[model samples]
Target: MKNDAKTRDELIGEISRLSHLIEDRLVPDNGMTDDQLRSELGLLRDLAEQLSESETAKVLEKPAPSGRVESYQRIFANSPISFSENDMSKLQTFFTGIRHSGISDFRWYFEHHPEAVAKCAILVKRIYVNQATLQLYGAGGIEDFTDGLMSIFHEESYRVFREELIALAEGATSFEKETVVFTLQGERKDIYLKIMVVPGCEETLSRVLVFVVDITDRKDAESMLEEMRKMLIRTSSKSIDGNNSKREG
Candidate 1:
């Protein structure tokens, strides 16, 4: 049982590392198209899943961990909403540096240095993501999801993140906002995003939970209502104009 666990861990770790390597090799001049990368990474994900399923059976035959841990794992894995665990240590360090640099007005600094906000975003590292997140982002696997992570964020999303950064800088531990993101297939989605820094992990900013709720349908409905309201206004204005002309004649 012990050897089985070790072998499984090693295999998973090696596969994850290789996936990162492939991601790093992605450059404009690399001559590899997005489709090719997705195909290759999809194969890696299939192999990893097969190995994991085989090893998990053996691991389960042995004594499992505490009931609490098992329960948390179950809930996290099967959660309906998109949930992602992120390591923000690097971003935390960057925040620390910003403070040390004596930037009292973070808003001004960020506004003036918009690129810095973009840089801060790239520093966040994904630790884990649930299946819902994979489906939400139209990702075949975690590797493809993480590799194309930044591609999902657009200018509007960055505006929301800028608010998040300001909140974090002002010592807030949680934030929520309505933003937009794109799937791997380039479909725009309106999302309600919430970010919470796990209680004990606040100092290091190592573990953060992000929840994303798809709100596109609601937004679309609201937009339709607004358009109907405008049409009604136009019809009323035309009727009023015809009545006034008849009265004048």
Candidate 2:
């Protein structure tokens, strides 16, 4: 028992250290690329998994101090990456009910019943949006953002949401995807999104963290490079054809 507690303490310390390291890299002009961000997040994910073990859960049963809670709230509010808290308890209940009804193969069931997937998505409700999330959707505040929520989601997002529901049904604690979204003014943006069920909240799914990173600029650069490559290929082909024609003449 002593060893278990000691290991849990070490894991918690490592999580804090990595969290601070990631935050430090977010400073301006740090040249932090998406890959670097992903690398750090990957480490954090591993830590989260370790912390979710049964022994660690027993060690963390007590609530955090008020001051520590306040500190975490500040970090979420000011983080550059958009973040939102969601409640998926209703969806969790729905899954349980379905299982009770003998729906063992969720993937096959959802595939055959598309409407069920949509219903599951609607069961999820947004509980809170941080400052970065409000700005990302060009909203003056959370109220405006909530009111205009339907306007911001591109049609493709529903497809991504379906995949998320499927993953959760299959026992995945996290999901990630690149998706399209629109601002209130109808400007399109490409973003990479990741959603994780808070480790302790996995049972109820009452608090899920949704992370959004705008990737429009990166995507645009890739598109331009692709077009340039095609143009060069065409030019080279035309030059070769001309050379062949001249030799025949």
Candidate 3:
């Protein structure tokens, strides 16, 4: 009877062990709820605690690693936004004395509307005005970077691009509508901008989020489409005029 009881315990333990092995092989992602996994992990902890002294030493003595920070550094170095030689110093100063940062989080760049900044006819690097802007460019903080964006961008826009930057810098300009020209640059007709000034967030430091999309082929197609539309409209109008003259005759 005692032998049978030991055999039953062994079977249950093996079943639990197999389940843990299955979970270990499973990739860690948010697709599934953590509740079940947490409960299973707790069970495993309890089993570990219940293990004999010799087994406990084997489990406890195994050392955990020190690779998480190094792994994150490697990922940062390999990112698409290459920090050039001239850019590194300002960036380093910006990162200096800061402990917490979302720099490793790739989603921030996409969300910050960087494509709009990248497409500006006259690029405005914060370093051009306030030397401090170098550090704040891609940093998660918004205040200093967004401050006086129009005032800062106006001169460069005018100097490099056009007079539109002057109005855009002054409070008189409204950028809410989508501009076709804003998206097209060079022989490539792929410039498009969706500019919106967020309400209650229009302070000098607050950013008027501009979303830019490149559709050069689409823009060229649109130009052709506009011409076709005009031709169709003119042809239709002429037909109506001709019919009116025939009716009068």
Judging by lDDT against the true structure, name the best candidate.
1
Question: What pairs collide in candidate 3?
Answer: 147-205, 183-191, 183-192, 184-191, 189-216, 190-216
* Candidate achieving the largest TM-score: 1
Which ten residues in a row are the worst by lDDT in model 1? 59-68
Better of 1 and 3 by lDDT: 1
Rank ordering of all candidates by lDDT, starting from the highest = 1, 2, 3
User: What RMSD, rounded to one decimal, does every model reach?
Assistant: 18.9, 12.7, 25.5
Give model 2 RMSD, 1 decimal. Answer: 12.7
> By the lDDT metric, which is better: model 1 or model 2?
1
Question: CA lDDT of 194 in candidate 3?
Answer: 32
lDDT of 2 by residue, 142-228 (tens): 666443235576668767777887788777878889898888878898887877776677788777767787767646644633554
- lDDT digits (tens) for residues 57-169 of candidate 3: 23223311322322322332333211211111222232221214435332333236344333343232332112222222333333434332332233223232222232333
Worst 10 residues of 2 by lDDT: 54-63
Q: Give the true-structure RMSD of model 3.
A: 25.5
Shift of residue 160 alpha carbon in model 3, Å: 12
Error of 2 at 242 (Å): 1.6
Task: Give the 10-residue window scoring lowest on summed lDDT in candidate 3.
Answer: 80-89
